[model samples]
Target: MAKLVIYLNCEDARSQAAFYTEALGGEILNMVTYEAGPWSDMPEKDKNKIMHMTFTAGGVLFYACDSIGEPIQRGNGAFFYLSFETEEEAYAAFDRLAVGGEVIESLKVQFWGDLFGQLKDQYGVIWQIAVENTSPSM
Candidate 1:
């Protein structure tokens, strides 16, 4: 099976990882600075930036690093979608992610029979949270 990992670029990847851990519920697996290795050729400022970091949240893997050239932009054609097994879990995540972030859509049952909502996090990342509807049909 193939694996998909989201690699994000941030102004301060180290701090971003911390915020992600607190908001998204994850543990940082590993982190590396650019002081050495292939990134040694980088400038002193870039050397201290996060070269790479791995985090795991709800069994999902994520990678993040600081940009070497152009900074990251908020404009998007993509966003992360998190699916939950229970409505409570979905709601809790939505609430937590909404702190200091913009809620594009409040959480609610949708026409598709699922609880869904969208938000843009403080880090400029967009997210869509959903939980399958288990209620019986009327």
Candidate 2:
């Protein structure tokens, strides 16, 4: 139905959004910038900034936005998961992603017969990549 994501406010929202779009092959639905406040009551700063953005990748819809006013407290939330169809795909992606990051876990035979690994990307986003060995229908 719906999904949500939080994006840190970086100096360049457009560029950051593009990078993520390319990396995940997600659809960049909207990328717009408007002049500050003469038109709306909201602060002018936010007008030129990315107030919000939406993307759809791999059959999933995700939302992102620029952080405002404060530093985001990192590493206090649940880990995010990304799944690959095959173990090979997962390891390949894991290697590519590890260029600026380190592999928290090298691909290995998981207790469930699938291979899995954990990593924190260059941008500080932690992910758990895995292959599903068991059928969900069971």
Candidate 3:
């Protein structure tokens, strides 16, 4: 059986998914545009809006979706991304995510020999994204 997947919620689920997909070397797995259907209860004008989106990036399953009502308050309370590749991934991810949310720390080569950074997505979910400068021994 396939493993369970995780997801992130945002104001524009599709846009957020796209942002993460670009940053994490991932693609939009699926998208649900709230159009004239049950998924979209809003007016026809809002039909083109994205209700939800998912992606598979960096071998990890990521999820995102738009906010239906009062937006959820999110923050980088205390979470970081642990990576296993070159600093490029960290740098790229930071650049992509920064499009929507604020960057608390820019991604850069760390003295400890790794690329690391932190930021909040459009939805306010705090994450620690990083990529080890050293390649792991097979």
Candidate 4:
């Protein structure tokens, strides 16, 4: 089986890593910064910026880095969905993710018989939290 890990580009990868840790209850595994020697030609402002960061949240490893040139834009037609097995767990996670962020939709029982919600985090990263229903009938 193939594995898929989400990668994100931000203006401040360091801050993003910290926020993810707090909001998603994860830990930062590793972080790399752009520096002299191999990055001599890069812009000065980006010299201290994060080159790469690896974090593990909810058993999933996510990768992030500072944008080289392009600006960081949220709601880029994508969302990172975090699925939970229990409704309580899903609601707790969703509430944490909504702190200081905009909630696109409050958590509620969806038409598909699942508890679902969407929000954009403080760093402009969109997320979807869900707990699927195991019922046999719709």
TM-scores for every candidate against the unseen true structure: 0.89, 0.70, 0.65, 0.90
Residue pairs with backbone overlap in model 4: none
Sort by lDDT, best first: 1, 4, 3, 2
Write the number of the candidate with greater TM-score, choosing between 2 and 4: 4
lDDT of 2 by residue, 34-137 (tens): 44325566565666776666665444565666655665555737665778887766776677556577677777767667668888766666767788777543
* Tens-digit per-residue lDDT, 14-87, candidate 4: 88878778777889998888873385588788788888889987767999988888887676688888889998
Cα-based lDDT at residue 123, candidate 1: 87
| Global lDDT scores for all candidate models | 0.85, 0.64, 0.68, 0.85
lDDT of 3 by residue, 65-136 (tens): 665557667654556465756666556667776777888887776677667787876657677788765654
Worst 10 residues of 3 by lDDT: 75-84
| Model 4 residue 59 distance off true place after TM-score fit, in angstroms | 1.8
The CA lDDT at 1 in model 2 is: 81
Clash pairs (backbone) in predicted model 2 = 9-67, 37-44
Tell me the TM-score of model 1.
0.89
- Indicate the worst ten consecutive residues by lDDT in candidate 1: 36-45
Per-residue lDDT of 10 in model 3: 65
Model 3, runs deviating above 4 Å: 1-4, 34-51, 77-82, 108-114, 121-123, 132-138
Candidate 3 local Cα displacement, residue 121, angstroms: 4.2
Model 2 alpha-carbon drift over 4 Å, by segment = 1-12, 32-47, 135-138
The TM-score of candidate 4 is 0.90
